[model samples]
Target: MPQAAKRSNDVPGTAPNLVHPAVVNDDAVRTALAQHMSRISGSRTEITSFGRKSSGFSWITYAFAARSALGGDRKLILRVGPPSGLFAPYSVLPQVHALQALAGSGVPVPALVSSAQDGAEIGFPFFICEHIEGDVPAPWAASELDPNHKRVIARQFIEILASLHRINPDATPFASQAQGADRAELRAITGWRASLARPTARYYPLLDWGGRWLEDHCPLPPCRTVVHGDFRIGNFIEHKGRIVAILDWELTHLGDPHEDLAWAMMPTFNARSRKLYGVLERAEVIELYQRASGIAVSDRSLAFYEAYALYQAAAIQMCAVRAFEVDRFNDMRLAVMASQMPSIVRAFERALEAAA
Candidate 1:
């Protein structure tokens, strides 16, 4: 297991100094983990493999191995919510309980070891989960997968989504997650609009115009499910040409199933091919989802959600814009995220007009 390297002025017998360019100090993290793990282990805990890892735009992650005299050793992943994360005001409760509820729902998520929102516990709300062994291919990268493998992966993606939709929400945290469908649509629009409503918002007239059109033309949700709000190619992990786990859940919520379908078809995920997410054409993808989930999808409802998904995408890009504008984070990724606004805006307008 990797440990932090020692600093010259450190205590005589502490772990080596952490020269891995970690965003947070390794010793501090070790101490926090020891304290937290002791509660479950009933003995002092040891943390190793304390290396920094950068996988996504939203959270700081540390990969580590832990052991205790009483509790066995394990490999784990830790996700910490930064105050100025890509999505601010972070809360892990919804995701934690949602994952808990989906334990047998056929959605392959990492096993949750523990979680907490108390800032004092781990600097910010944090959770530990099994370190899944899988690789996420770059969605924009050229195909290393043969045609057969690509088709299989594509089918698995939609099938997992269908399984998620079939899970009963009445007994889960998402039970009371929305008002009526119209209200929910309004809320989605309002929430995204708020991200760019500031005086400093880098506004484009089409963005505002598009928002209004979506509000005026809000259609009822086809049906509600626990929407994987960011469901797309890059968000899942693949092992042996199969999607082993659906990784990011920060945007998990209860909403229209169409939202996920439309979101997967977003421009960023579909750029490489005419197919949605580079796997299946729009009609074919929808066909698979409807067949697997046993729900008839309306073309009109899909058009509405397609436009809504683009609106949401543009607003999310604005989050990166605001963060970059104020230097909330120094990661060049924020700049990159903000840079996509022009193309995303164009895409949004095109989708909206096509719907009209």
Candidate 2:
């Protein structure tokens, strides 16, 4: 169980005196960065104005610029493990590997610069890449975009997901990373169940029951493909009404393609556009995906995964709350995450009942 939030180097909060020593202008990091950038564009440079902050749970993102010997500036983003501790067992290395494999595969992810697993240099594993510049409208503010643009972005989201699903699992580097004891179908079901088992009282009997249903009625001839464990509105970057880059690959893995589809369709993530789960109606998203990737998506399958997505999200939120309650790591944002669980659980239960 996650311990209650305590003052730790990893947790971020308003402690006036607590300057994060974990983040500093160190010589070794600067040297490594300079060398890495040298390889990219033959530029000998130094990291200038590196700033780090938590985007949410489990992520410490740094935005910085590199001044080249030629006096040009390149903006970059570095995503690293939190100083407190990671909320999930998965590593960022695989996300980088998957991104590398998908380069030119029609997926709309950020362009990768470099990734490192050697934790000694930065306290924990981290990856650096190009910083995508665009607007990510708050869920409530999604309406500010023109309705047609919203529809275009919505369709784009589904099509990009379909493109990822079409990637041959064996052709990707993360194939070994995804190797597990459970069969594909069982793996998908168990993964979500485990994610939700974090300490909390907002448990849903329907999710527990739905797990059994999924196990019993496994999809026919399972799809062994890459799954973006968390695919939602907040994860993408948009500019001029087009999705420029997909962010947050920390949860990428291999499983049924429907897993990604379901996550994208989760109601809690729908934000302001309640009319469409992820700002697009289920039918519209499905049609766009089918048209783009030439694959058939059944309504029944979408419904099953939709329920599973809610279960997965509720589990993540509960875990965040548990971290706060147990003093394992405390931040107001994480504590507030706990309060969202009841609504998430209620949504799942209603979906499960309607499906039944």
Candidate 3:
């Protein structure tokens, strides 16, 4: 099994450098993980190598190789949501349940090993899964990518999204969370608005107008589908000219499929290339999505979702600002996000004007 590379300081016999609070007490975490694995597997298990990895903002992930008498040696990923994350008070059950349902359902996801919802086992709610090999392609690159390569990845992207939306929410764990499409939209807007209403949240006038517009023009959904809440260019892993896996399901929920499509088409993800995600044109995306999803998409409905996406994005930034300034998270990423608020508001204004 391939072991996750450890920093020189992380190696035994070296003076360990400081780690994020989320992953502090590495020795304690390793011991706890091994013990948990043993109890679950009915055999003694050992964590041979452990390395904390920097990945998503919400979940703290670590890559490790484990050896057990029953399960042998395996490379795996451990993901835990910290209280200090941008979106705090997370439950791993939703992510774990969605992953279990998607596995072997034609959507590529890491195989679930085991999951727990509280800190009693691993010092935090977490889940373990098989470590898959792939490279993440960042969305902010300025270098020109080959057109053919972009097309192949784009095709895979839309097809996977279509497959995800085709899933029956009633048959999955999300069944309990399901609601009418209109209710889903209202709930999302209400939740974000609540975040913005927080005393710690930064003020943005455009957001007020944007929120009103969203409520005034909310569209009826064609049907409810499992929406990948943060579906976008940077959320997937691409290897060998194809997307190997769609990552980061923290925001997965039962909602309108167009919500995911609109998020993926956000201008920020386009790298200023004036193309959707800097890959497909707007019409091209709609055509491909409709053909693959077997669901008709209207221009008005898409426009409404596009606006809602911007509103939700600005609200997320506000949450980040609060996390950095009021919550006092030690992560500098949250501070940087605070600095980007101006650009976010500007984007919100442009989107609103376009909609007008």
Candidate 4:
């Protein structure tokens, strides 16, 4: 196992020294990356930030400018796994495969450029892909974006999810590698139960109760479809008043589509706009999804998954904080993200009570 890097509580939004050209000094990795980019874009490429950090979770994201041979420059984002390895089982390749599978399916995702599982190139697995150009509105933007834009983006978000839920995992190239299951409820409860076993400042009885309730009251099975594990406004790029790219596939899997719905509707991600869960009314989002997917949104099912989403998020945040406490926080993003758990738990409690 690679040794973990020290944790740094660096303030968010402070761009690291990633833009300096010499930062990518590894000869072999640079050669390979340039070759890969050339193959993809037919360009003489420069890999500027191999070791520097960019965004999202604990991974090292390198943003590079690709000047293609034919003309035009394109910005690309590369996500390299942390040296200490990821906390989740899903790898970069699986995410790439998922994106590729979703192509032409009416779901907007950043186009995947290339993916590799080999650790030799960058000390860990990494994937390179196109960067969607748009601003991720601050949590405050929940109320800031024009109400009509908000509604359009909100409706698009839910409708795209409906399309994602319709994807047939078995028909995709990743079928053999992707775990097959209609056991969305079972796996979600069991997975979170295991995560909750880890040390935390306080054990949440609500989580335990929620897990049991989900197990006992598993909703009627819907058509199996893809679930964007971390479906939320923060994970998407809204451009020209519409969601152009759905970002972050690390938590994606095939399961109950409602899992995505509940996660998106979770109040924690509501970003302070109480009127809209994540900037759009819950009824509006559900109605949009129902209209697009032609599947009815069940009140009971949504309520159950809402509780499950909260419990799962709380458990995951505890694990994140624990990792930081253990001094294993290589990525400052994860460390600070862990610190937000108290607020998250409070939101979870509120959602749970609302469901009750």
- Deviating ranges (above 4 Å) for candidate 4: 1-32, 35-45, 48-55, 67-74, 85-90, 174-185, 277-279, 327-356
lDDT of 2 by residue, 129-226 (tens): 87888976555566566787777888778878888888887888778765565555577578667755654546667667767776676655256777
Query: By the TM-score metric, which is better: model 1 or model 4?
Result: 1
Candidate 4 lDDT, tens digit per residue, 1-356?
12344445556888333221112234555566677777666667665544443443455667676665575676778777654443633367657777888876788888887787774445457887788888765555576557777767777778788888767767875556545544655876787778777665556676677666667777765666677888887778877787788887876666677788887876557765544534576777778788888778778778767777877877777766665555354556556766677776676677667666
- Winner of 1 and 2 under TM-score: 1
In model 2, pairs of residues that clash are: 3-326, 3-327, 3-328, 4-325, 4-326, 4-327, 4-328, 5-327, 10-83, 10-84
| Reference-based TM-score of each model | 0.87, 0.81, 0.88, 0.79
10 residues in a row with least lDDT, candidate 2: 16-25
Candidate 3's C-alpha runs over 4 A off are: 1-24, 142-144, 179-182
Q: Which stretches of candidate 1 lie over 4 Å from their true place?
A: 1-26, 177-182
**Which stretches of candidate 2 lie above 4 Å from their native place?**
1-44, 70-72, 86-90, 178-181, 191-213, 272-274, 277-279
Ranking by TM-score: 3, 1, 2, 4
Which ten-residue region of model 4 has the weakest summed lDDT?
16-25
Greater lDDT among 1 and 4 belongs to 1
lDDT of 1 by residue, 207-323 (tens): 888888888888776666788888888888899887988977877777778888888877577555768656688889989999999878888878888888888878877876666
lDDT of each residue in 290-334, candidate 3, tens digit only:
999998987777777887887887888777667667655556766
So what's the TM-score on candidate 3?
0.88
Give the C-alpha miss distance for residue 249 in model 2, angstroms.
Answer: 1.6
